[model samples]
Target: MNDYAIEVRGLTKRYGQRTAVEELSFVVPRGSIVGLLGPNGAGKSTTLRAIVGLLRPSSGDSLIDGVPFSALDNPASHVGVHMDGFGFEAGISARRHLEICRLAAGAPRSRVDEVLEEVGLAADARRRVKTFSTGMAQRLGLATALVGSPRTLVLDEPANGLDPDGIRWLRRFLRAFAERGGTVLLSSHQLAELEQVVDEVVVIKQRALFAGRLGDLVTSDADSLEGKYFDLVGGASA
Candidate 1:
């Protein structure tokens, strides 16, 4: 198998005259957790969207295991995605929603219950989505992603709605996934959480800025990831 689970090659995205991402390139190593770090409007979302084929790039390409997301035969089986504000019908039960996704992915029906338990949503499985808290909704999104048992996960701001305990749980779960040979590319506003979980970090300021092992970014002189992040992106914003 390839050492890289995902590779972006000179990826660029534009909106009319405005460029969102420019010549971005990076790689998520196989069986590792990589953090995509950037400030607001730094094209993090745009970059991720392009990888999942939600938007076409104006130039360059993104590849998963050497193939574009659109070209994959059974994409859900290989790449599971959880973008910000993933939606569901307000009235649908969480269980029903997962069942629908399982059918669409042609995954086994047993996957629904398995994912529910895995995400700690089995107890609330029958509850309407509208009644779920932000944390619950996030779990549901994760469950949806896991239903296909994909080898790679591309999640955007997955820690947004999670509380302290939930964040801890997620850290443990993702680490365990990587230990099991799953690749993870996670985008997050929480630098502290990223530092705790990611094996590598990719920083961007509307373009590729830094890509390296987590420890490399944090020099002996640097105090923390927040300080490093500011040093990396602070100049760009100013």
Candidate 2:
């Protein structure tokens, strides 16, 4: 199998006269965590959506582990995605949701319990999703993503609405996940939190600006990723 977990070449997405992502190309190697950094509406979400087959690009294509996302026989097994919302069945218990995903992915039942424990949701496994706090819901979303042991993870703002402790847990979890040879692609406006976790970063302004290691992007002595982001995007700080 190819070493790259994901590959995008000449990616472009346009809606009428407005272009969301333009001529973007990047490769995420196996076992690495890559952060997608940009302001709101900077095409970070759009790029991720296109990569995960949620949206079709006007040009170019994305490959997940050497197979085109569109052509995969079981796309969820290869690439797991978590967007902004949990999208859980509010009436179902968290454990039940995971069990459904496990059956669909053909994963062992043991994996359901394993992922719940991994995301710190084991205690709430039997709780109805409608009763979950935002952070708990986010954990459930993460659990769903991990249920199949997917080779690559595409998450847009996985940290959204998380408390401090929850954020810390997520950072540690993602770091460990990457360390275990899993690939991660995460998009977030929370650069402070991202800098603590991501190994590399892909910064997109109104366009594709930079793609490299995180340490390389923060060389300007900025105290935070948000500051560096503004500098790169040519926007003045408030």
Candidate 3:
């Protein structure tokens, strides 16, 4: 088994003449939650897309448990991913949508109910995706990812539409997941909210800026994560 759950070696992505990500590299250790922080267009999303095989890297590579994402025989079983724009058929019920994804991922049908309940969407299981509030939809998206019971989770702003209680629930859930040997990589613009959950921090300013334990970024009198964030990526722009 590899020491890290995720490893990116010089990963880069380019769009026409613009470079979205430039030789970015990082590692997510097994059983730890790491936050990917960056200003707008700092290449956080680009790097994540490359890692999950949503977009191919122009150069370099990323590996999940020592193997490239594309090489996984059952990818969902190894890594569950949720990007900012996860889409669901508006006409389908949440339960049906998860049922479909569960089948596609080769996960047992029983997992559909388990994940739905786990994400606090069981009561809305029969509701059409279009009828769900933003918070409910976010929960559904997380349910879809959880259906596979993946060892590693890669989520982009998973707390976007959640209420305070929901956010607290998510924090506890992720902490428990990591304690059970699951790995997590989360990216969010909510620095204060992020401070409650992540164990490590990976900050980027159109490039790799800092990567280390969250404690390292918190100096005396600068304990707030938001303060450390601005200090690290000041003047960064899209």
Top model number, TM-score: 1
Candidate 1, 1-238: lDDT as tens digits: 5789999999999899888999999999999999999988889999999998999999999999789999988999999989886799999999999999999888998999999999999999999999999989999999998989999999998887889999999999999999999999999989988898999999998788899898898876547888988988977752
Candidate 2 per-residue lDDT over residues 159-229, each given as its tens digit? 98899999999999898888988999998878778888887888885367888887787776646677777
Question: Where does the lowest 10-residue lDDT sum fall in candidate 2?
Answer: 229-238
Q: Regarding TM-score, does 1 or 3 come out ahead? A: 1
User: What lDDT score is found at residue 109 in candidate 1?
Assistant: 88
Predicted candidate 2: what Cα RMSD to the true structure? Answer: 2.3
lDDT measured at residue 66 in model 1 versus the true structure, 0 to 100: 82
Model 3 clash tally, residue pairs: 0
**Could you report the Cα RMSD, in angstroms, for every candidate shown?**
1.2, 2.3, 1.4
> lDDT tens string, model 3, 43-148?
9998888888999998999999899999998999999988887799999999999999999999998999899888888888998999998888888888888888
Name the better of 1 and 2 by lDDT: 1
The TM-score values for the models, in the order shown, are 0.97, 0.93, 0.96
Displacement of the residue 196 alpha carbon in candidate 2, Å: 1.1
Q: What is candidate 2's local distance difference test score?
A: 0.85
C-alpha root-mean-square deviation, candidate 1: 1.2
